[model samples]
Target: MFVTRSVSDLVADSEGEGEKLRRSIGPVALTALGVGAIIGTGIFVVIGEGAKLAGPSLFIAFIIAAVTCAFSALSYAELASSVPVSGSAYTFSYATLGELVAFIIGWDLILEYGVSVAAVAVGWGGNVNEFLKATFGFVLPDAISKSPSEGGVFNIPAVFIVLLISVLLTLGTRESARLNAIMVVIKILILLFFIVVAFTSFHSGNFEPFAPEGFGGIASAAGVIFFAYIGFDAVTTASEESKNPSRDLPIAIIGSLVISTVLYVLVAVAAVGVAPVDTLSGSDAPLAAALNEGAGIPWAGGLLAAGALIAITSVVLVIMYGQTRIFFAMCRDGLLPRRLAKVHPRYGTPARLTLGFGVLIAILAALVPLDEIVKLVNIGTLFAFVLVNVGVIVLRRTRPDMPRPFRVPGVPVIPIIGILLCGYLIAQLPWETWLRFVVWLVIGLIIYFGYSIRHSRVRLGEKADAPSVEKA
Candidate 1:
């Protein structure tokens, strides 16, 4: 359980590099990538459901969730600065925890990123159909626009969008980051528009019984809202591609979380102020509904559909990119075929891995019924959070003098709080989700012992403190 990879080898891999991942992303682009992953379905849709549980105090729930995320974010920033692995929590686990735990977290991340991309793509297809119908009086047939579970033959739009984003990724990381930044700005503007429209009918009466359901409800709502913050850590997965990783990675990770949390709180305040909690919870399109109900704006629904289309698309792009990078790191660690991690000579990206996962995710989106499966995405992410917080404490004791560009203040204390908070959220998941998670971990153990353990670079006499020579 404690076959840890030496930190020296981890750092040495990126030093004196020849043919390797390039550092093309700056701090601003990296922060945009984090924002793109964060402000999607949570703000646009999940806020309504959270309102159901927390009543008018849904704003408080957003705060609770954001605080929980902040602790984890600090831990992530610390590990990301000092460890500097593109595998994110998975690599962090290896450096401090062990290879077996790393494999478990790696497997968990695969489920989180892959399923999230598919789920978000499916959502994008729905919102785009609504946008097209509202704007052009045309909608794709159900057969091509939805999964079979939603009564469609094959979701053509979902598959098409995934492939399109995949192509953008294959072109280069910098190109994809540029497009993501533009989409992030547009979506933030659209959300700001909603805030403006919602305030036009702000009523003090909406605050009469803000905590109608009390602290119990607020905590429950926080659990539901926790999933929305999963994508911020996706920023750390781009460490290898960052121009100045130690500085930029932490800023992107924490800055995105802080920016996203403020937006989340402001939007929640605006939403609850515009409508009663019951009314907010009743609608599938709560943000748009609030605008129309509050200010009598008939076109608000179309505007929001447009926002959802862009917002969810950026989420898919960023999460899918994170998944592929983690795969690249794992392959490089010898958990999988090293050739699969090859950087494209022209694009300087992991084109092959990115394209392959894109196609697989597209198929999953088109064919799979992911309603229940999507629940696993949240649990998987929370599990990684638990491991990351744990890794921070473990590494500090193990490597007291490691150079850290960014450090989590009050060592052990902050990380312990992070672990406890993450555990509280994980407990909120259903017993069925736990059962499924265990089954998934069981499968991961099988793969690790059967294959990964033997092939791991650290286990293959590659654990020397000195850096290995890079091949051109």
Candidate 2:
């Protein structure tokens, strides 16, 4: 029989664990972490891809995606505030939905966080190579620096960065959070600089025929631009580390979404203004290309590339961090191997899981051309968002007496909108992406039936009574 975990028991497990994650992040740092994760390749690269699909109306797409994310963010805020645990949507699903649903979301998060880190790592490798070639006239050989699909042996730079970030994460979460904050500032400043310089070359004529392909184009672009807002959920993953989770988690989650939306809209406007959509679509380094070739600012291109390197670095760090935490949560619940739940004795972070994810992601980054897989990442995230919004409604009806520090306003209405919007965005993805999502879900089901269902701690009577309370 399927049973839902209770919120109280979930909280109890976190506190009862022998080694606990240290609470070291405050609102300011947590907000910065959200910005760091959200502002990476989406702004630097996906903006151009989005522009390619929607032309100047990419601005409208940005608004659509942002609004959708805002609704979902409200759902996340309420759950994180009430639970304040480490599993993100996975834990929330476990509390409100059944173990099967929670396990599905947890498996889906692997695609969201793991593939995202690999995709961003590939972007980082390219930016670093660009910085080297432009600044010092040094380029690593194509054989070692390019993915196999791109006609190279392996992407050494991507592998190297993933491994390096893993070591940093292993060192300690607090130390990594500090470094992430600094990098976030540098990334934001560089983007602001791009907006300033690009504005100087803005032409009114560029606004002509804005919706070249009409609303269809806008919706398509919204689907692509959804990738930019992917990192806001990373904030909820840090609930265990937040000094004041009930208050800070909501602020960090919503605050980061608002800040990233404004920046993305501004950047999209500046990009379209300074360069023709066709030109932006053709280039890999869209932002840098706009500043250098389109706006006639040669030096700013190099700086933008350097900033992109830092931006992608911070993204890989946070996404990988989220991945480990999700795995840590699953391991703790006996949905996966318990050994992965071991925290570092000294650092107090999930060292084993962190290292495990890093190695797997490094291998993925080193060999795969992640362009196709990035869409898969988006689909997985949207799926989780859909489940989370539903979980909000389920929890509200089932646990009306539960203490919620930050309640999602409008309750059923807001969550319903969130669900419909997320479903729409998921439908916007390619049919191929849906196929891939189904295949991955099937694999997850096999693993769950084969391993997780039998070994679940609740099934073993460790926490059997906990689920019955909710069942009653």
Instruction: Give per-candidate clash totals.
Output: 0, 0
Give lDDT per model, in order: 0.86, 0.86
Compute the lDDT for candidate 2.
0.86
Residue 114 C-alpha lDDT in model 1: 91
lDDT of 1 at 138: 93
lDDT of 2 by residue, 103-131 (tens): 99899888778888888888888888899
Model 2 clashing residue pairs (backbone):
none
Q: Can you write out model 1's per-residue Cα lDDT over 346-427, one digit (the tens) per residue?
A: 7888888899999999999999998887655378788888899998898888888989899899988998999999888777
Model 1 RMSD vs true structure: 2.4
